[model samples]
Target: MKKLNFTSITKYTILFLIALLLTVTAIVFLEGRKSKNISLWITPASYFNEGWYYFDSDSRRQEIDSLPVRIPADKFGTARIYHKMVRSSHYCMYIDYYAHHQAVKAFFNDELIFEYAPPSNPGWLKSYRSFHNLIAIPLNRDGILCIETKASISSTAGEFGQIRIGSRDELLNRIVSERLPQFLLGAVLIVLGFILFIITAFYLRVAFDRTILYFTLLLIFLGVWQTEESRLLQFFIGFQALHWFFEYMMQPFILILSFLFIKELFINKKHPALIILFACITLSIFTQLILQITGIAQMTSTLFMINSMFIVVFAYILVLINLNFEFARKSVKVIFSISIALCIVSFIISSAVKHHKNFTDPILYLGIVFLFISISIFVIQKTQKQFNAVRSAEIYKKLAFLDISTGVSNQTAWYTLIENFSADGIKLDKYCMFMFDMNNLKTINDQYGHLEGDKAIRSFCECLKRAVGKSGDIYRIGGDEFICLCKNIDYTRATQIENMFDYYVKNQTESKVQFTAAHGYAFFSPSSKADFIQAQSMADKAMYENKILSKKGRS
Candidate 1:
């Protein structure tokens, strides 16, 4: 790895430059748009941000047409509409606007003109009117037109947004132009989420990355949240109040997944506080869910505050982890530092805004994008480490079973194989065990040093391997001692192979010193439960007896 300080500085510089470029570009984009006055017709909705008869709570609205504009888009509650008679000599007045998770009532000069169904009404939920619905409020009022609206969630700043009071055709055009940006970006995010989901599902191996999986889930929820909040889902699918479910549920989803992501990222750290915080968040979500489902409580006010606290708490944890250095790498520290700072700034800006109609702060979304990139880098690095560790373990395991001198199975492998066969509750059939002992290994070692003796042993083992080939398994038990377990081989073939081994020992010039091995074989017919070990013992005793016979013949 590069020096931590230099790598950290370099990464910070690049990230800062990228953020700067994006920020400047955003500023330029915002600067390009000229603010239009309320009286203009180019964008009529831009004129009606405030300045109308508005109330969040239940109260009788008075009919009166006020001035041009009053409230900003970020302030709470419905699109306030008052009487604005068209100067046309023939055309009747009609108002067009967008309604969010809210219902409205309009009064014409203190007379009940119309009462919009509340979002809680099943009829409202079943309406084909999307949140992007350009609701047309027809007015036959000569005196005044009064509108009052409220949202389901008390914590939500505004119930309805993008209010426009004008001719139907002009407001329709404005609707299209204003909603285009939200739809495009929402679609892009949804597609990006789907792609990430596929990558998390398919490319992972035996030992998978949980962090990436969780992060992918986070992306998916983020996309859903953005899409629903953008009112595009309504425009596309005609899902009216259903967006409220997504809007409410997404915070808990993000919170849970983020907790899991952080946990997976810091495997080495044991933070009891993190665990406790996760538990509290989980409990809060479940309790709120139960209450919302049972009609015991509304999810708007309390859960909103809880979600806000979760963000702050999670940010604080990230900062503390990064600062400790014991819990975080330099790259991770840099990422978290940027993340915490961004979170704070975004939170402040969002809170300071008077009318926050957007789904989320754009600054927070930017942080989310960078956090994802950093996490991906960490996952790739962590996965490589896991792969290397697995490879090392396999190499070590192979080394434990190998005989360095003979390149065959060592005694450890021999014992392990027996234990496995026994544990598996299986019996061997048509099996033969051959036991062999070198005739003069001690004499050869004494006369020609240990290296020559080792050479003789290797040559004998190599010659035996050639004769046996794939017909059996061989084990180097001890110095000058060996065993071969030949499966599926009849007695005759085992004898022939054994004789071939003896011939190679006597005539093969590969060994520096002439040598022979006294060998004996035991065969088992059909099958026997204890056959494997019994055959080995019998073969060993027969080999020693044969050794005595060979010494007598030599004498």
Candidate 2:
């Protein structure tokens, strides 16, 4: 029942600031000790069978030597060595220096099955230094194979920091020191999301209407997806399979959150655009599921493109909704812009990694972090606004029902009251009705002013409202006339209400303009009573008689 203490932005900013501080402090203090850059000494044959591999990182020399292992020639159609190398330990700085960018050419009796970096022109790393490639090896009729790496680079050695390999035994050490920081940060973010979900669930009874349940579920899903352990599912099922599943699942959830978040933000739910967006998302999800089950990976690119388009469109709608509100508009713009930027970055990273097996760098995950943070903030801001709007609406509804001048039920609300108390019978239970008129109201308006007459009415209604208390209804149906109706009346309670009105008048003033109210009542058994109409007519006449008696006494 208290007013909102701060603006929407102030409240939401505090929330995100606290979360950010905790995350940053924990990461810096707990895991800040620097980790050595690990050399990835893995090879394709490493997965085929188990073997030992040597990883060497000298001043400018990066080498990976895997012991002899059986190459699977029956499957994968012409097996080859894929060279994927990335500099580790340095974040926020582009280190794309390839000291020696050549693959160790594999051969079967000198018959070349494939070549790794097909003879590039000089100065390829004029901008940066990194190398990733796949070198092929031929097989004899006896399933025998030979594999080796050949390297040629400038004599000028470059200062390099770290190296990682994906050969035989090193396969278990999938994530290295540099990668752990990012994965850990992701874990923290996911945990924060879960905490938020728990907080929301606590107030679930108050806030969980039909609409909010959808968003609550979404937050839970997001929390689970961003966890470090969730990513470990990749080890059980291959990375490619996990990648495909995630890409397909993200579209539908994004659409649901978009609609729910926007509705909460603006506090308006009548937008027609939401239906169309949902239809598109549902269709896309269904289409993607079918394509995935059909064992077709080539169509994934096209599916991704279409899905990305829908996401962009959904974010654009959010931008439009946010533009109307001054405080939220800027935040919305920031969120949408970041989303688009992240989508583009991820697309580029994925394509680069696909064409050249450079999966070591952390571009996609970085974008994901930014995207989650921005969207989470936006969702929280929206929820707060929705809460305030609903609260204000209830206040306004109560205000509308009562007469501000009389502090009693207005004529507009009296019928609704009758419907609530009415019984199912030809005639309702015994009741008493009191009608009141201020004596010489026209004279008072002529002598003093309408304002003075208005004060008398307000004062009388206050007395009436207080006296009615828990057992009766009072109405300001006319300018100077009022009605009090009591159901199943005991005259003792009735006399108290009437006496309280008289006491209020007697204590106020003894002037000529002293106001008094005429009272009347009618009681009957349901079988004998005619109806509300006939009963009210008798009460009206009785009240008139009392008014005449009061006038005579005053004279």
Candidate 3:
């Protein structure tokens, strides 16, 4: 109702937290009532014993959530397990283990289904003793799938293990867990971002802090890319090609966000590194696209490795910039660190799952939450900093032009305005100027003290300011003298303004501090080399004539 009121960091933080809480609640509510026809089961490390039958545990373990097993260096041995499948259509089994070679044999209710060896390189921390297995076992009826693992007899000084299992819809769930929530979160951010854009567009006309507005928009685009990649939405919506396209396409958004975020946060205007980074991102995307289309394994491998390394390197660069800029406060830094950590964790989980089967990780959504909060903190801090800087500048500017006592333009500011007019040259062909000297200010000060005389001067200035409207500038050039310059105006407007001031002063019945003002007008050509002093002299003479007339009237 109050248009978000994001003037303070606290208000913006509160809004972000509320939005996050609402999103989580909605996701949970949406997931709670689902009735999808898919087999759901958990496969822990010790699911079978003695290679004969499968068993269910009475208790659940924390490590069983996504099947991250730790195998010690000494206990290197083989394990045989028999798993009975109740009913199978199109089924997938995912196994994540910390081993090199875990040979698997599958059996279906006394009949052998298949026997195969898990890939030697499951792509889990390459050269480390970690492997993941995804086996798809299709069948027409309910049967038993036995898994007998034979450890490498020649293994020396390292852990050898592999996770083995088989199920229906495990692949879909794994893929969904990796990409769905992230995609949806991205869509939400994009929509909300445009809404913020609309608000910013409206405020920019009157707003002094343009930096905050620009950085906020950059963060919104970052949110979009994080969502698209994390949710694998490209794959779901656009097929395999879409997935491949997104893998490269998402790179540009990341590069752009990093460059813009760092630039805005640090106030760096001419950093060539940012341009280079964008070009690199563009090149990488093109290379990746070509590699995916042509299916060049060598090129693909080289590019993937390079991209992954760049991610780590660029993230480190961001950290360096964050440290150097000091743009983020302590609270903001903590939030950013946590979010970055979660993002790294999400990437690790996604990469690990791509090699394994059955086990699914829920880190994508968690990472989304962290990234959003981090970006929110950065954005809020940046906005507040910029707003404070601009407001301080405005305050200084106001002080520069204003007379402290009279609350009107001072001599210094009057000269500054004249200089500006000098730069532009005179455009108007006709104008009015008025110069006034308060009558007997020295006598008034001696009789009634300086304070009373000062009050009279301030009152006159206030009246002149009110009567001047938008056509004139009022300047207190001296203690007793003031000048009012009105451009693109004639004697008629000046007379009207003078008459209004005189009427207001006459109607005041409380005070007897009588005041009088004199004014002058001229119609000089733009080509004439008339300085402000010449105009002031003409106005001063005209004022003297008016004053003599007033004195004669009083006599």
Model 1 Cα lDDT, one tens digit per residue, 1-555: 666698899999999999999999999879867765354345444345444554334555543243333332234544555554334453454455454345666666666655655445642232222243343444443455566555544433243444555666676567656565655555666676677556445553325567657766776776777666555565456444556667777878877887777776454557786677677777788887666666566665445555565566557446554544332256655765675666555655554552453534565455455445544444555556666776788779889998999999889988887766633236435778889888889999999999999999999898889878899989999998888988778877988987888788788787779997888989864343466778888999999998998889889
On the 0 to 100 scale, the lDDT of residue 452 in model 3 is 81
Q: Considering lDDT, which of the candidate structures 1 and 3 is the better prediction for this target?
A: 1
| lDDT, residue 79, candidate 3 | 43
lDDT of each: 0.65, 0.52, 0.57
Window of ten residues with lowest summed lDDT in model 2: 90-99
Given candidate 2, what's the lDDT at residue 412?
68
Rank order (by lDDT, best first): 1, 3, 2
How badly does each model clash, as a count of residue pairs?
Answer: 9, 25, 6
Q: How well does each candidate superpose onto the true structure, as a TM-score?
A: 0.57, 0.50, 0.57
Off by over 4 Å in 2: 1-218, 228-284, 295-369, 372-402, 415-434, 485-491, 509-513, 521-542, 548-555
RMSD of 1: 11.3
lDDT of 2 at 390: 68
Candidate 2 structure quality by residue, lDDT tens digits, 1-555: 656656976998999999999999999876756766454544322232222222233223223344222222212123233233233342211111122323334444546554444243222321111232233222213322334433333221222212233432343343333245555655666566566666655753236443345455554554444432234434444443344335345545655565565555444456666556556666766665555445342233334545464445546544654565444656566765567567556645654464332362355555556556555555566567766776788779778778887778777676555445445578557777776666677877888798888787777676666777767777776787777777787878777777777777666652336777776656544433245546567767877898888879989
